[model samples]
Structure formats: C-alpha cells, structure tokens
Target: TAKASAPEGEDRGLSIVEVAKARMRDSVVENRGQPQTTRVTNDEEEDDAEDEDSGQDHGPLNEAELSRMAAMLSASALVVASAGGRRLRKLHVDLNRILDGKGNSGVFLQYVLSRLHGIERKSNTRLNPEADLSVLEPYEEALNLALIVAEWHDIVPQLQEQQDPYVLVSYLFNLAAEIGHANRVLRVKDMVSNVAEARWFLFWAAKRVLEQGLELLGLQSVEHM
Candidate 1:
C-alpha cells in the first residue's frame, strides 16, 4: 500500500508541474502575438527636426534692394529739372522779344493777354502775379504801331498762316529789332531758322516751367512733359 500511495503522489506532483509550465507558455505566446510597440530611431527624429528648421531659413535681402531703388529714382528727377530749367530760360527770352513789340502792339498785346488768360484758366496755372511783365508790358502800343508801319495789304493773311499768333508776333518783333523795319523781305533760310528756333525754345521753356511748378506742388515729374 505504501509503495502504491507514493507512486500516486509522485504522479500528482508531475501533473501540477506540467500544468504550471503550460500556463506560462500560453501567456508568453499571447503577448508576442499582439503587435510590437516599435522604438523610434534618434537619427530619423533628428533629420525631421533639421528639415523643419531649414524651411524657416529663406534668405535675408529684401529691405536693402527697396532702399536702393528709391534713391536712384530721386536722383534721376533732380538731373532732369536742372537741365530743363536752363534750357527753358533761354527760349523764354528769345521768344518773348520776337513775339511782343511796339508797332502791332495793340492787336498783338490783346492776343497775347487773351491767350495767357485762356491758358491760365485751362491749366489752372497762374503766372507770378508780381512777376516782371517787362517783356510784355509795352505790347499793346508796340503792336498797334507795327500795324501802321506794316502797310502791306496782305499782312493779316501772312500773319495768320503762321498758326500761333505769338510766334508771328515774335518773328515780327525780332525782325523789327534786328532790321529796324517790318515789311522788308526775308530770305527763305533766315525765315525758316528764325521760326524753328523760336518754336524749339518755346516748347523747351514751357516744359521746364511746368515740371518745376509740379515739383513745387509736391508732385512727381510727369513722364511725357
């Protein structure tokens, strides 16, 4: 009986050991079958960080270029104004003497004053009220006298053909000043040169004054002036 009982106890001890081992194996297998929690690499994380930093580092040169461009434009404007003013002054003197004078003074003076007023109104531009009217002051009497002396029956037609009465008056005045006579015939070249010069000067002066005035008014210089 003792031997049989001892064998039974040994069998029971073996069965308990086997059951414990089987439980441990099942627990380990179940844990392994579920997904693994992957460990992230430090090199990949560092590379991602570096990429983010690089995205924020776009170059550094916007403000300097803008300042340079503004300065260049201002310098260009000054040069144009200085050169233009001098040219205009020369033309004004030449044209004024040619167009304003004694003999045809009344008619031409009326014409000049009327034109001046019209131009002033249209452009809203005012001549200096106190500016010296020396060149034009005697135009009325001078033009009338010129008309009397210029007894040519076709005077009106000839003068009108010149388009701008101011130009014709200038031409007549210059002729009178230089020649001391009005009705004298002129060579074609002399006539052409005189008219051409007067027109050039007049246009140049007008452009200069307009630009200067705009500058004074705190406006940008017009591109086409």
Candidate 2:
C-alpha cells in the first residue's frame, strides 16, 4: 500500500516505499555485475602464483654438481677405454716411438699386456670370448692417435696427402682393418689374434712409459703425458 506523498505544481512525489523498491532494484543489478569483477581478480591472482611457482621449480644445476658430473664422465671414458682394449695398443705405439731404441720391444710389449690384464681383472667385467667382432670397440681418440703415429713415422705413403690430421688418423684405422693389418702384423704371417686386448695393454704401458720418460726429461707428466 504505497502512495504518492504529494502533487506539487504538476509533478507527483514518490512515496517512501516506492523509493525503497527502486533502490533495491538498483542494488540487485550492481551485485550481479560485481561478481564478474571479483571472479576475474581471483583468476588473475591464481595465474600469477602458478607462474611464480613454475619459475622456482626450474632453477639451474649448482656448480659442485656440474663439476662432479664432469669428473664422473671422464672416469667413465677411462673405464670404457680399459674395457675395449684398442686404446691400450694406441698408447703402446706412442710410447714405443717416444722410448725409441732405449728399451727392448719384447719386454715392453709383455709389460703392457700384463698391466692391461690387471686392469681387466680389477674391473670384474669379463670379456666375452665369442662376443661380436665390433663389441666394445676401441676409443676413437686412441685409434686416431695410432693413425697419426703411423703417418708421422711414414709407415703409409698415402697419409702424406692428409690435410686434417684427425681425419687422416680415422682413415688409417679403417684402411688398416680393410687391408688386414687391423690386428698388428708382427711378421708377414704372425698376426696378433686379439688386437683390441693388445691395444688396451699397450695403452696402459705407454701411459706408464710416457710418465717415466717425462720424469727423465725433467718435465712433469701432465694429464696423459
């Protein structure tokens, strides 16, 4: 039962109840619009928080961890060289050249083999007698070194044209295998049966010899000497 309060001049005045009904209608409209604004604000805050958390989770590795990882990789490479054996042979050839005429070849070769055998025994990873020919192959670095030695000593004539020394070394190993010197030939017919094993032995022996030779020359053996 709301009524107009007064008619002044030609205008009608609204009653208190009508004014209250109009205010209530405006309030409902304002409330419906306000929820969307509040929801949008909440959504934005959630998105920002997720972004911050993602950034925190993806931090870089620390310096100590990186150094330790590098050391472990180097150790693994050394172990792989020991297991494969070709690296040993490459070492042997290099050492023989360095020692050149100072030591008996037969004795040196024997010593190299024994050292390699000892490393294998320590590793507890038995080499398969009937494994694939290409199983646990020689390290590329050692093979390259052996090739370089051959080229430097003029063992092969075609190596003279090698522009990139690294490439030449790789080529020599491949060619040697193709031409049947993959196992080093002691004589025309007496080819070593297990070149990979011999190579590993040679590698360790060569490392020892080089270290000793450096000491003799009054220079410290740095890295692999």
Candidate 3:
C-alpha cells in the first residue's frame, strides 16, 4: 500500500521507502484533482480493445487501485538506497517497462505465476503440502537456493537497521534469477512421480518467499503481468 500523510509540513523521521511512497501517492492525488482532457492514440485504442476483449473495465481506477499503482511506481524507481549526494544528469522512469511485466518486478511476478500455472497443468490439483523435497536434496542449485533464503532472513535485520531498501530489492532479484536458472537445469516440470511432486513443493516454497519480499516493499504481486 502506498501510504501518505495528510499534507504534512515536514518529513522528519521518515524512512526512505515511506518518503518515496508518500510522494508518489501525493502526485496521484494531485493529478486526479485536476481537470484534464485525454488523448487516445492508435496504440491506446488497441490496448483498450484488447482489455475489453479480456473482460477488463475501461472505467477510471478507484482510489485503492490508484494507490497500488503509485506504490509499484515508487518501489520500481528506488534502485539505490543511498547515493551519498550523487546526482544523475537524466533519470528515466519508464512506466511501460515497470508496469508491462518486465525487469525485477515483472520477473518476480512472472516466476510465481508461471510456477503455479505449470503445476496446475501437470497435476490438475493443488500442491501436496506434505510433499517431500528429499528428491531435490542432491541438486546443488536447490541447496544453494535454500542457503540464499536462509541468508536473506539473517541480513534483513541489519538491512532494516541501515534503512537500505536497495539490498532487499537486490536480494529478491537474485533469488528470482537463481530460481529461473535452477528450473532450467532441474526441469522440474518434466519430472515424473514423486520427483515432480517434490519439485513442485520446492517451487512453491520459493514463490512464498518472493511474495513475502514483495509485501515488505509494499508492492503487490499480480496474477498477470
């Protein structure tokens, strides 16, 4: 959720994440209050048509929806926790790349959704909560993933104490990337019998970890990009 104070005077004692979220939320609110005309170009028209075909509404977004979008935009833009007063000549905020299912945000959601879809297609049933991951014990990548998650918890406290969002975000990016690589090598979806079930549980565990990380950043994972 993108949290914002009620038009506060000073931003004292606010964490960097809070400040960013508040600014984005305020921007959305100000823009919504303005009187404006919208131009629908050819590409936009096509996009609207596609959305309509998919049973999506073309109506204006509600407050909650707007807040979520603002949150994601803020989270996506905060690449560095602290720059030591450094400045960039040009900073680009690519809304398309951020929202269109690309980059770290997209990769995180994509891995989660893809795993769910793959599991469903293979089993046609829910993942077995008690499925044994023993089949994955011998895999070096699997063990490495377990270690990454364990390490994440250990560093979280120190990272929070330092007020560094960059490290947390980077951790998620690496976690997602490693899972993707492991899936390619393990071919979890192509396994048979207990191996498939076990790997499904492993993937589910990773998905849950990703979801927890996204929640910490106040970003919601999407079912679709």
Candidate 4:
C-alpha cells in the first residue's frame, strides 16, 4: 500500500490509505444526504443553460473553474494509458489531438448531447428517466444499438481489470460514429411523424452509458464543447 508522511505540526502519524478512507467516508456522507436531480424541466433547463453560458464568457478563472479545468487536463492525460505494453515504443503526446473537440471525447459528447437537445426540443417535454426502451424491439438498428449497451456492460469489467482507458475511449468514439450513421439512415429528424419514443430512449441509454464511461475517466461532460 502507498504511504504518506503526516501533515506538518501533526502529533500523530497517518498513512495515505487512512487519509483516503477518511476522504471516502466524508464524501459518502456528504453525498448521501443530497437529493438527486434526475429530471430537468424545460424552463429549468433553459435557465441552467443560460447560467452555464454566462459562466463561459471571457473572464479570469475562478478557483472552482480552475480546479475543474485542472481535473479535465489531468483526466485527458490518461489517454496515455492506451499505449501500455511490454514492448518499447515512443508515443507522441499531441496536445492538438488530445484537445481536439472533433476527436474521440469531443465527438462523443457533442453527438449525444445534440441528439438529446433535439429530442427535448422536438418533443416539447423532458425525457422520463424511466422511459421504456422495450419499444425499440422491432427495428434491426435498435437491436444493434441495444447490443452496444450490452457490449458496454460486458466491457466495463474488463476495463476495470485491465485499466485501459483506450479501450473505453475507442469504444465510445466508434459507438458515436455508428450512431451517427444510424441516425442519417433513420432520418430521425425528417420523419413525417413526431420523433419516435423508442429511438429517443435508445439514444438516452447511449448518452447515459457514454456519460458513465466519461465519468470513470475523470472527464467532464460539457453542455457545449
């Protein structure tokens, strides 16, 4: 186990494991008492978006914003985990590639969020968190989409065991590409009828999975990238 020296001026000794356990306990308690906000109403969503946009205006970084940016940068560095192996190899660290908004992380977030916004805007209502995906049974593409969800579940344990962020990141990037293709083929936006509920739930599932994977990588899911 890792170890750490006690803080200066402390009378008692402490280890890193103890410090970590204490922090985890504190976090659990703090979060346990907070109510979860799962659904956002239309008005509330617009207000929240406006607030976020206002915060994004040109300005000096506040402590919290700086901290989040630090976290994002730190998180992005984990992409190096993708290059792990026994063989000696030189891996170029390309800031441009890593930070590309059109690349893996950015594309995944943008496509999923855009589809979500489209659904809410066209439907004139927020999605039910408990929305039924079973309605997606008939369509072959939906089955393929469901397979993605199942694939995510299967891969998660392997990711945890292997500690390979590349596998997860690549999975998300490819999933985003596949969904983009499926969306074009379905013409979800141009349908003569209202947006299909089943497809909405499918996209919702996709978004949730992507967000979960992103969170695992210590990444932020931005409203606008």
lDDT string for model 1 (1-225, tens) is: 001111143336554224323332332234223222442336444333322211111112133332332232232222222222322243221211212222433222222222322222223223343433243233453343334334333434664574433433433333333222211221111234343233223322333433333343243431200
Using all chains and alpha carbons, the TM-scores for the candidates as numbered come to: 0.17, 0.18, 0.52, 0.53
Record all residue pairs in model 3 with backbone atoms less than 3 Å apart, i.e. clashing: none
Whole-model Cα lDDT per candidate?
0.30, 0.31, 0.55, 0.49
The backbone clash count of each candidate, in order, is 20, 6, 0, 0
For this target, which candidate reaches the highest TM-score against the unseen true structure? 4
What is the per-residue lDDT of model 4 for residues 1-225, given as tens digits with 9 covering 90 to 100? 111244333324654333333333333234223222342336555444432211121222333444344344334333323332122444443333433334554433443554554544444433555655565565677677678877997779888887765567777776766665555544333332324555656666776887787677665664321
- lDDT value for candidate 1? 0.30
Candidate 4 global CA lDDT score: 0.49
Error of 2 at 153 (Å): 24
Q: Which of the two candidates, 2 or 4, achieves a greater lDDT against the reference?
A: 4
RMSD of 3: 10.7
lDDT of 2 by residue, 59-159 (tens): 12233433332333222222222222332143322221212211322222222323333333333233434433342244454454354334423423443
Candidate order (lDDT)? 3, 4, 2, 1
Select the stronger candidate by TM-score from 2 and 3.
3
Report the C-alpha displacement of residue 187, candidate 4, in angstroms.
5.1
